[model samples]
Target: MLTLSRRFAAVAFSALALVACGAAGDGAGTSGANPSEANADGELGHVLGQADAPLTIIEYASPTCPACKYFHDTVKPTIEEKYISTGKVKFVFREYPLNEIDVAAYAMARCAGDDKFFDVLDDLFENQEGIRYAAQNGVVKTTLGAIGQRHGIADTATFEACLSNSEIRQALADTYATSEKWGVEGTPTFIIDGVKHNFQGEYTTAEGFSKQIDAKLAELGAQ
Candidate 1:
């Protein structure tokens, strides 16, 4: 059976402690593409693929995580083509911001609304290298503004407003809280059929992921 590692357990505890103490800042304002359908609580996570697929995969990933960028740029397309588009699997992407900047990124993506959330997210991941450089150079806002413009955001003001939206901040915080409850300590954590799977220095490739996913599908008689 899959289990949470001791290190991850400690990390989860620390994250919960931070939430309990309210250390996670509330940043402010909001905007995006037309609002997409949301969960019962109005969280704007984007789900791709068939809703009733026998296999369900939810990924908790940080925008700034290099591993996540790699997964999105490489493995994700394959998964989409093979399983998601084929109606064999349902995939959900959840934001688990690791820092203030990551929270800002999530806010921007969420504000893009459900219709454009995944597109914005894809742009963010594709340009992660440039974004990291901009962040390091203290020009993250300017860089993000340009990115938003490319993705149909109205203007810099709108982009900034979205980044500062309090509601979006709360939604991101709630996502983190849920991740903690699930013992998710790191980015790109995959929850397959309610079982948590950490990267563990392997399974970073499409083939690797498929091996596990296929086994699960076979076990569930969904293949």
Candidate 2:
């Protein structure tokens, strides 16, 4: 079992590479309404809204994070309705797994592939409480296996294989490296147009987030 302290230590070291290499943009343009695109490797994370939306909001989150679940359940819908659907904001979800189980869940979610990624992600967040219970009771494998089946995975073997995939694990680690470079200290961190925004405990609601985003859009002269 991977402990959080050790994981964070790894992040601290990997972030040194980021400093040496310089801060790379999220494969999106810094000026104008440059559309977000999958990297050359075809990894775009899980994205929503148009690629060319004026504002791109990159979120670093873990499926098991309670704050992340609240954002998904309470805040995301409002943002989708007001910004994503309107082409004003493009959203990108990146994995910042906080524990072994979080890594497993993310791997399985990606194993489902891009078409079903967000759907599986939703299910995971929505059922987080049950998953936590299962983990505490030592049935995490069974719990996650059932969740995988519900999302079209064949069986426990397949789920285990997905969880053991080196490639997927590497990709997830790379995402964490990027997040570390960006100074993400916790889950539910947001980066708007390359500017890091720590959750200030003030805007956990849609209205609050909107106020900040709208202000940024106006500053950038984006409609």
Candidate 3:
């Protein structure tokens, strides 16, 4: 049920996702922004959990990725409650925007700042139905802007400003560099304690994810 413009956008996203496979992984050009890249201060990406948590889960996700929306809607609550809230797992979220609209979403998320990143993400995932509808009608940006205002971004001018914010742009580029290092080619790719886990049929449920995480924790003697 995509409108013409939305169909075009979807095609572009798929193309960019394919291109990211090649564009993101050129070694020296990546500039040391892989997952392991961090400062003495702390982890660089949006994060939640105790710093010394037994296990770390790094996720590269797209705002417009349906599978990602599914994960957020269903599986994430369990993982967060059981692992993250319990101080057993640390979660890091990075953007892997696949198109211009996806980039706009990421920019607004960044503009919301580190403190509100997860909140903004929560709202986005919770409202994906509306987002998808808006996308089909060629008003995705307007829809996202409405979402942004609810998060204090306020007004069309500032919302547009978020799209071109240089700092946010750089952070996103760094994620592509990180994806290059890790060979991530899809959404909801989870790196659990350095192991890359894909989000698909087997990983659409919390039980499946917990099985892998529990095993990893035991193996690391952190269980």
Candidate 4:
């Protein structure tokens, strides 16, 4: 049984290489791996977004990340409404679990399945502080199970099973590996095409984040 501290340590170590790359300014770029292969699985492939969209923005986040929750719940909806829905751009979400706490959260999110991913995402964000305390106190199962029950998951057994799943942990590790390759340092980091944009100050409001996105998009040639 990996304790919360142990899990978070492993997760942090796994991302060290990425954090270094970010410090070195190695930066991230579009995969350029061909949109066809990317869209083959309906956007769960290498890149996450509409295959044909002119602008693609991928948000790398951890469910337990406060900043990430703020960005997703506050900043993201506006971006999605104004850009993603209109098809001017595509928004892709990638997991960049920052700690053991985040690992559990990520597991829960994945367990929710793709169709329910966003729903679970919102739920977790809503209770992020309580969940963090629960994780620290080794009450992850209780905290997360309660969340599952609220979403009508019913079977606490299945949900707990996901927490202990080796395959799921390995998959999470792989996601961190990919983040390392992309030079990700922290959560709420946005990558447009190949360029990385670090948010300035507290961008907790939709208007603030939207302004940055609009500026970046225009710089990328929205004209």
Judge candidate 2 at residue 152 and give its lDDT.
88
Q: Candidate 1 vs candidate 3: which has greater lDDT?
A: 3
Residue pair clashes in candidate 4: 8-100, 29-194
Q: lDDT by residue for model 3 over 1-223, one digit each (tens)? A: 1112476344533433222221333322112233343322245578889988978888888776667777887788999999999999988888887666677887898898778888888888777668768877788878899999989999988987888778788877876677666667767677776656666544668898888788878987988
Worst 10 residues of 1 by lDDT: 28-37
TM-score of 2: 0.80
Clashing pairs in 2: none
What does candidate 2's lDDT look like per residue over 18-49, in tens digits?
Answer: 12111233432222222333232234467999
Estimate the overall C-alpha local distance difference test score of candidate 4. Answer: 0.62
Q: Rank the candidates by TM-score, best first.
A: 3, 2, 1, 4
User: What is candidate 1's lDDT per residue for 145-190, written digit by digit as tens?
Assistant: 7878877777977887887788877887777776654556666677
lDDT of each: 0.68, 0.72, 0.72, 0.62
TM-score result, candidate 1: 0.79
lDDT of 3: 0.72
TM-scores for all candidates: the values are: 0.79, 0.80, 0.82, 0.73
| Cα misplacement distance, residue 109 of candidate 4 (Å) | 1.5
The better candidate by lDDT, 3 or 4, is 3
Cα deviation of 111 in candidate 4 (Å)?
1.6
Which stretches of model 3 miss by more than 4 angstroms? 1-5, 8-42
Q: Which of the numbered candidates is closest to the native, going by highest TM-score?
A: 3
